[model samples]
Target chain A: MARRNQHSKEELRAMAIEALADLVEREGVDNFSVRQIAGKLGYTPGMLYHLFVNLDDLILHLNAQTLDALNARIDQAAGHGDPMAVLKAMAFEYLRLAREHTALWQLVFSHRMANQAPVPDWYVDRTRHMFEQVEVQLKDWVPAADQRQRQVMARTLWGSVHGICLLHVENKLNVAGDVAPEAMLESLLDHYLSSCAREGEK
Target chain B: MARRNQHSKEELRAMAIEALADLVEREGVDNFSVRQIAGKLGYTPGMLYHLFVNLDDLILHLNAQTLDALNARIDQAAGHGDPMAVLKAMAFEYLRLAREHTALWQLVFSHRMANQAPVPDWYVDRTRHMFEQVEVQLKDWVPAADQRQRQVMARTLWGSVHGICLLHVENKLNVAGDVAPEAMLESLLDHYLSSCAREGEK
Candidate 1:
């Protein structure tokens, strides 16, 4: 009897999904094909059909994976440090991912993340958990900020950091020099923080 | 016999571009066809061909109009107010435009704007002129702020505003109901300006 492959169902599923990510970047999402994916990996289209009904199903899976990767990065970075320092670090980490994974970031982010098919409940838990960490860290920084202001401030920072990252990925900023973006972001954050310090002195 | 249309050339061009914008929303930039534009209005594709060489020419024309519209909105909102107020108003106007015209905003924004064929020098003039107006206005607010701090401050404000606008358009904010975005933005502006005033005091 021929030796049987050792991979279990779950292992095979993981492998297929990993392959899908590489395929998305190589071939833009709009043109991706289930047949093409299976063909490149020496699996028949019939096997892919068994796993995913169509490109939408594959897209939903990829979207969830991207969010999980983002949540993991933030979680890992937040592990040890002053919460304020870690919050700033998380901003850098988030921007770095957006820069490196522009195509994938654009794909999932261009469509609202929550609008996609629901991922496992843990996914929402992870996202909300990360935001809560950010919120608490921010309160430590701006103790006088009211609950509403705190929420809005957090949202503003979220937008500001993401904006710079979006510009970096899209080459939107018109600056002449090749300045390190993260360094520029650090400077911006420092100045913003200083303004707050000066405010509290009054 | 060809009958003369009542609308002036400028009016016709403007109307046609409005129709073009509608087509773009229905079909994204890549899928858009000049033939479809003419067909929708019962005109032959030849009419569109006569106005522009290809899709690039047409898109460039449409995008230039968008930049012009931006300048008009900024002029209407900010004029030569307090430097900080000018930036604040522009931020508000930018958000308004982005929220109102989601697809068109993405098109006219930095990345897509740069990729299109080089517009006339005046077109560049309009964009730069607006930035220059802000740079000049920013002077009064940052009288005490160092040059580098001022640069970073302006950049941060602009980036944050852009980022927030995009997040809103993407429906990622989950802003509370019954609160106009303007109200929230205006309140945030007050908070930011008050903080800046404290910075100026020191």
Candidate 2:
């Protein structure tokens, strides 16, 4: 077993989160356990509990890290560009993130705590922040849209994009053909946004 | 314990499936097991294998049953009416089904076999039939639209509706308030279909 005393609290936390993520990636959330993660990190279960309130807290922290990484990717994809182009870029980046991190993405959407525990505010904030990035670009595209309209539009579009990604990631969209998810996202964005275009905007 | 020898083979199969569904409902798919199912039905593991090719096959059959139930609800909702009215009705019924059968709905969208087994064709056919219901209505609403447009439109709208339902089901959409999922569905349908309305039609 590795010595926990050799690492600082911050270092131990980071290592535990990475080990948890790796476990989720290999065995999926369904098969995940705190003991397995503690074992993997060469720490006692007591050491893990000392670091985290519980397994759910640890999972939430891992999810928060995922949201942070996704937020960064979206920020990168939104590098100064025409509003619509940046929007497209962001959606593409979101798809890539979901594809590259299928298990984590699935956990974000599908995993619920043991007893319907409320998701922490910080976790919710991270989710809202990701959409706020989309809403920011949306304002540039449709300056006249109101706050509620922007909110709904942001949720609608993100949810739609998420569904597309979910279908692709879960292997529901195309199995035998090896179709690129980017092509599918391109068509969906074209169809959806064209429909959003005002009468003369097209 | 259920008596395995007392029931006919068909009765045993039905009992096993019912027990499986109950297990999924109580514990979620993450905790599902064929042994639990066999135990519930007082059947040997060997007997379950005889009834099903494996657990995956049994789960597929359960998913198939869910699709059938959903299809029936959609058909009932589609009772001859104005095309838009029927579409709205269908969407509401879908939300109801998902809310009422959250575990089954999650399994339908999220679960996959461990070995990447090909989804049986009949399963694919059931899914297509659900979309075909929407396609049939779209034909009535947009007769001028061609086949490819109908296919894309069907998938896009369904994905959007699903995204909306997913957010609500997963408790991400309206955590702090009692915002009705029906209200969200209505706004999405209005925005999506109004955008679909042809110039003359609108």
Which one wins on TM-score?
A: 2
Q: Estimate each model's TM-score.
A: 0.77, 0.83
Task: Return the clash pairs for model 2, or none.
Answer: none
Q: What is the C-alpha lDDT of each candidate?
A: 0.64, 0.77
State the weakest 10-residue window (summed lDDT) of model 1 chain A.
Answer: A111-120
Candidate 2 structure quality by residue, lDDT tens digits, B50-151: 788888888888899999999999988777997788988998888898898888888887776767688899898787777789988888877777766666
Which TM-score value belongs to model 2? 0.83
Error (Å) of candidate 2 at residue B123 is 2.1
State residue B85's C-alpha deviation in candidate 2, in Å: 3.2
What does DockQ give for each predicted structure? 0.33, 0.35
lDDT by residue for model 1 (B9-73), tens: 56656666877889867654344567887777566777766566665566767777877787788
Q: Model 2 chain B, poorest ten-residue lDDT window?
A: B174-183
Q: Which candidate gets the maximum lDDT versus the true structure?
A: 2
Q: TM-score of chain A, model 1?
A: 0.74
